[model samples]
Target: MARNKFDVDENLEVQFNFGHLKRMMGYVKPYKKEMIITLVLMIIANAAGLLSPYLMKEAIDSKIPQSDKMGLVVLSLIILATLVISGVCMKFRIRTMARVGQCVLENIRRDLFVHLQKLPFTYYDSRPHGKILVRVVNYVNSLSDLLSNGLINLITDFISLFIALGFMLAINVKLTLISMIGIPVLFAVILALKNVQRKAFQALSNKQSNMNAYIHESITGIKVTQSFAREDKNLDIFREVSGEYRSSWMKAVAIQFLIWPSVENISTLTIALVYIAGVYSLDKTITVGVLVAFIGYIGRFWMPIINIGNFYNAIITAMSYLERIFETLDEVPEVADMPGAVEMPEIKGDVEFKDVHFKYDDDKEILKGINQRIKAGSTIALVGPTGAGKTTVINLLSRFYDVSSGEVYIDGIDVREVTLSSLRKQMGVMLQDTFLFSGTVLDNIRYGKLDATDEEVIAAAKAVRAHEFIMELPQGYNTEVNERGTRLSVGQRQLISFARALLADPKILILDEATSSIDTKTEITLQKGLETLLKGRTSFIIAHRLSTIKNADKILYIKDGIITEEGSHEELMAKGGDYNHLYNSQFIMLKAV
Candidate 1:
């Protein structure tokens, strides 16, 4: 029930969870072969690089002292070959993993988008859209390097660390032990900073989501802001939100910046200690070549430790993003098809509400045990004051929401018993707010029935009296429209939406304030088309204009979750009830106008 706003941070699990890593491996499962090849290449590259220091020791101690020119030349050629082999392996490994990373990104994005489509309206109503967008786009993008390279690097670095240690031990055990003296210190430092670092990153993510939400809300409502001359106020809010994001970034980065320096300082101290120990060793057999080779191994050993530190950083950051991504994917749709639900048969349009009760929330009942029935091919009108549950009735009938108690039936079958797609496909609903995608005039109308032909699209537009205005456009039906049909006036957009609903050829049509935006002249013209369109279809019309519903077969006056009056225009007028009073009030207003 918590509705997220621009400033609020979504609740998140602060503790790190290994389950996320296990789930991530599922994405890598399909590319196991590629990863194995990459790993093998990494091992080969590390092995080739490892041999260089030992080869240097031999050339300096054995070949130079013995004055063996051929031995040195032969060794030099071997070193070049190792370098070439390592380079080639790394080249192929990078290419292979890059391809695998892109594929994983595509799959995750596809799954997230598909799931978002299935989520009910309430899910979206509760959260800022920008918060959702950041997880899908920004957070998912952040995981690319972690998934593609971090896993391989972590394994390779560990292998390199152990191998380097083994070589150092064989060369000089005392110096090797001395070189590892700083490891425990480095580990202690990381452990001390781990919790704080993670918390910092989590805070950063929350701030980023908050700022993004504010930006999106501002952009979407820019017109309203400008109309009300609230630009300065909006800018002030944005500045505050953006400032928090900057502060959080600094705090997180300050924590991240601590890791690399600790590793470097420890590596420096370790090498210096190894130098002192090697020089003062009791074992007089320790030669310059051995000491030099051991020092080379020391660098090799600590480099992997630094790499591992970086890998840990990547994991922590990736985990923050992973939590949000999975959280969205795990959300269960509030309204979904029931188990064993059947595809609805061709609708006969006989709808009945049997003691229906509904509420969006527990405390406020929106509809209270309302009962109504309409025969097939009948036109019914719902008239009521604002917030009187008129829209809720139609929403329940369409199964946009389920009834809290009682049942809504279509042709004697319960709505919840039928598959949502099959049920909605037969019902054409034109909401108060008409939305049009960026496309041609013909395309927007055809959205109702995707496979509809141009001829059929034109026929529907003409039927709704939209064909004339459409033809007057530069390219007529082919002229492109911007998003939300911004190029068209409010009346024009409604007309196109009307045409779209008609083109669907739905057996049951529900129009909620569908004609409120149109001019009186256009309404008169559209009414003639409506008379013909309403011939054999069951229609539910919700209108504030009494003139529009005066001829409807049945008119139900809804008020405060109950039907206060029910009858035709003359019947309600004769009763001098709520409907008659409402009609008279509007009639007087129209006369004054």
Candidate 2:
């Protein structure tokens, strides 16, 4: 992993950001026609609902008193028809909005995933897998309902409120004024509670992400936990994380539900004032029919206010999720293709390091002022004590990380000047840690070259002498090699990895302690395969076993970020340098074992 600019902050702060909402609107823009249609449908639905009160008033004030049977029948039919029309319009509006919401969600998740792939390897090193998963799956999911229904529903409610108000005022202005006396109080209470709700919901989102990270880490390390009998300890830790999440969730819920009862109380108080005022005008200027319609409109009015409160709650929660999602999307790749980078030419495998210097951190340098040049088709063995910058050298050659200063070149061309894909395509690397994807045995080997045929895969396996053991398995090459190839032994896994690398037929090959896991007999077979694979190809081998690289073209004995000795095994032994000391130490240990 290369150095990354990502910082691990324990106390991640998330606030309600209007800019996040504005960015989300870009996704929604594609579905503008659907949104407009839904809005029109909502208006038609609310308008139909508003007409009912007037129809009821007409029946009461005129038809009933005059015994007009035909008028009463027609009014009853009109009320029934409006009810049907409102229900149908609302149903379609909800369906259309939901379709639009799902499309936006799909696009956001796809974009986030594609962006993650483009980010440099170091970005993944700094963040937990679970945290990334949460942003893609959980956080994106949180915004679904808000985008689907909440915004449009809020609009629908406000439209209902205005329509009801117009009807109320037309009936009696004084009564309408009295009925709305508590609205300001409702608004003030909602504004006050909103801040508390935002903090609680944001806290809830953070705790949820934390819990997910811990669970994923624990599950991935379950084998180590159980082998050491630490299951109980892990359970205790999980309990603490889950408890925090639950507490945060409940706190947010408590704040959110407060809007309901607070609005209900204000609603009741306003209706009481209107009812009391209506009593004085029962048989006067305001008729019984008008008073009845006013009461119905008052019910209609408060219902929307209650809905608006719920919508406000949903939006606040969604804003918390959206903030986290966009923050991830905003991360710039630390390593990216330079503008106008030339495509790598056909590689000759001539690699060079010119006064190279690097460090993951600013305070300490891992490799200092290093210079070396290796010819094409030469095998160079790198032997070093741990942390002596051996693997770092391989990483630099691969352009996994750019030099903090100085230059690395391949075939006399600066690596930084080449496109990454063209440079990496001709190199094959098999590291100490062997990873095999979940698939059949043949499939895993074929991964080196996706278009390789079965015959080619089998030939590669046979070259590394993995064919015999693979055939002994229940289903041979067709056998399922589960996740991480857990069904196979470490040695078996390493052999399969070697075969995968050989199948690629790369011009430049790197074996970083690749033979460390194999048994003596298998190691002998692998050495023969390595000789065949290394012919006419530049190779760098990092190994603890001195015998494996003793016949190399050159051996570099590195210590403390510098090459302490460089020569063949016989030459180094005659000189009595660091290489001699290491070879003797390993020989004594092997004899004793």
Candidate 3:
């Protein structure tokens, strides 16, 4: 089972302030023209809303009281015209907003997804796919809603409040001011709630991020938990994480409920005070229509206040996500080719490591002053105890990570000074763990070189002795290998991958513990395949079996990141050094077995 790789405190910040939502609105800069058009339509729509109170007033006070048929007809027609305007303008505004929302989402997703590919492997090393995916997609969706619907409603509420307030005052100034008495109180409440809601929303968002990370990690290690009979223990852990998320959600909801009711009660109390005060203080003639509109405006005014308050958290939270997205996109990938870096001419397979020194981190030295040279078309084996930096050397040679010191040269060209893409193209690598996507066998082979023909694939397969078994399968080359090629045996998977590496026709090759998973019989057959695979390529082979690489032109024994010995198999055995001790012990273990 995988160990717990992250703590809750580690991800809390991502939940709270995504950082500078206003800065992220820069993504909508491209859609400015569309936003302007939508804004015009929305303004026209809101303008028509001001006519609502007037139309009702006319219908009741003028049209109905006058009983003039022509006046009523004209008034009805005008009301109908305003309604038509609102409806049509609103439709145009909504359609344009939707289109812009979708486009903005697409741009964000595309930028994030592409940036993910450019991130260093160290990123994926620390984060699970599920955790990062949930954060990326969920945070992005939150931002979209805030930018689209949240923005639209905020605009609508402001427009409605102003227009309604203006029309109300024109009809009955005293009652309009009286009804709006609690507005400043509402504003004060929102200002207070802004800080509380920001904290609450931050907690809620963080809880979700933790839940996603927990669920993803749990599922990935589910097999290990079940195999070890620790399912109950795992379930308990999951329950704790899930319960924490639930508790946070409830707290946030409680706070939200608290906010609206407090505002509503204050608004109601103001209305009551106005009504009581209106009768006693003045003999103002206020109609039912104007009073009703003021009452409506009272509620409407609180909406924008409350909305801006509630969305303060959302805005802050979205800004945090925006900062992370931009931060990642702005970072330069490691191991990019240097400016003026030249592509080396076709390699003759000669590879050199002149005092290669490396480390994954600064504090620890994984390799130290390692030196080696391989002639064109020769196999070299690296033997070492665990942590002896064997794979580190191979990874450095492949340019996955540049050496911390010293240099690697391919055919006399310094590897670091060559275009990274061009340098890596000369090497083929297959690790102990094989990676196969869901596809036909033919498709997998063709992955080595996208434009390789079917004839070349079959020829490559036959060279590796994979063609015989492939033909025996029901669909031969057409057979579907499910995710990670689980349909095939470990040995068969190795063979397919070997064939893939050979098809690349690279001048340099790395086979890191490639045969460790295969059975002995399959290993022997694979040994034959390896001979053909290494015929013209300069090869570096690392294996625990030791026997497979005995034919290596040179064998190097590594200890604590330094090469302690180097020679042919017999020469090393004859030397009776650390190499001899290892060989003798292995021989004794073999006889005992």
Candidate 4:
């Protein structure tokens, strides 16, 4: 919930605190049993792997020294058999761990999705869909690597390193200690490069999010970009953004590239320095078998050292997203009713707004101290200039946002005291923007009432005069509506929306300029459908076309978030108030068009 945006450092690293990481660890719970079994297999595989060098030492020292040819063959065979078993076991471990990782990722994704639906309207208002998407994808992906490969690598490396060190020490403690002289230097090198790797990956993740946002926006607004002739410019900007991703990838590789060479050089120097020290002692205690085994252990030691460094970065990055995901999951839904609150009462369509005050943000009030009461089955027409907060009244009625101050009562029940789902069930809303998903016309109309029959869908569509036009298409109700219903005209989309709201059979209706985009013929045709849909419902209409609401029970002139005048059309004109003034101002334009 921190308001701060992600800011990459000079080294392009993102920092995660202890609290964030600790919470992320909870994701490991479900896979604990599988993880435990995989860990055991990993230890067995690594220990068996370390045993190969010991088997080699025995093959060279005893079998060769005594010239036992059969014993030598049998030892070699046993070593090969152990390796085969180890490889199969390692493969099983990989497969099992991978399943566990996938399960965790699936749960995390599901949990994030469910939590998103529970967040407040304002949470979505302030955040972009793309940023949340990046957090979900990048965060969950980081955990997948650790749960599958990182954990396995870590367990195997630790076991192998311990077994190798134990064998080397048993043979010659002095030589083993001398060989380990590079340990501190290796640690120092890994520690120095660790942040570089972390920062590089963090930068890559952020850049990728940026690229994703650009892609989403460009695709969604492809028409605008093409109409403005800016595709090439967009591509150039995208290249600039993608350039950051390429640089970060290179930086990560460069940091990791140092580990192998540096480890090899240090190990070679340590071996030479140790052999020189032993030479002066004139001791033949150091066997060739022991030296060979020590070399193998040195290889094992440096690999884990390098891997541990990289794993640190993965854990850090994964933990960052974990924090965000958990934060979302922990969010308490804002519009939830009180514990003892009741379901909505049977509404009679009577509504009262007692001094409602609202602000989209703190400093800019959108609605201020407005009071009104409407009868059970009356139609109220709201008229105002653009940005006069008329639409905000409809938003409040539907409880999209809680008023900053005031009470809105439906059927004598405070809206906040009733379950949101129950409260919303009685209201049908059609917005200024018509949104239709990718589905058939039948399905889209049925979206308002999921169990609505085919007959009902056709009825609702016919009511809105959408059925005739729909049948003119190739498949009628089954016709595929592409994304945003792009194939249909804006007015046509609005008609479908009106049908959807009509099918819901709500007690109260809100028409947010439902006919604004449609032509005159279409609007006139829809009048009967609108009237049928509005019959017996407490309705609120917001439209630029003042003529549509000429039969409304009352007209409320709203300005600066308050009701300036209220009367029927004839009454308002007779009073010669703000409503009459506005009506007179628009009379010429209404006639001309």
- Which candidate tops lDDT? 1
- Which ranges in model 3 have alpha carbons more than 4 Å from their true place? 1-7, 11-19, 93-95, 266-285, 296-300, 316-334, 337-348
**Which tens-of-lDDT digit does each residue in 367-452 have in candidate 4?**
98989999988999999888889988988888887889999999888888888889889898888789999999888899999999
Question: Alpha carbon lDDT of residue 584, candidate 3?
Answer: 78
Model 3 — which ten-residue stretch has the worst lDDT? Answer: 1-10
Rank candidates by lDDT, best first. 1, 2, 4, 3
Quality of model 4 by C-alpha lDDT: 0.79
Model 3 scores a C-alpha lDDT of 0.77
Better of 1 and 2 by lDDT: 1
Better of 1 and 3 by lDDT: 1
- Evaluate all candidate structures by whole-model CA lDDT and list the values in order: 0.90, 0.87, 0.77, 0.79
For all predicted structures, in order, the TM-scores are 0.96, 0.92, 0.88, 0.90
Model 4 steric clash pairs: 13-199
Whole-model alpha-carbon lDDT for candidate 1: 0.90
Candidate 3 residue 519 C-alpha distance from true site, Å: 1.2
Give one digit per residue, the lDDT tens place, for model 3 in 148-192: 666666677677777767776777677677777777876776677
lDDT by residue for model 1 (140-221), tens: 9999998778888899999999999999988987888888889999999999988888888888989999998999889988
Q: Distance from true position, residue 341, model 1, in Å? A: 1.9
**lDDT at 211, model 4:** 69
Q: Write the per-residue lDDT of candidate 2 for residues 33-109, one digit (tens) a residue.
A: 88888888888888888888788889899999999999999999988988898989888987888888999999999
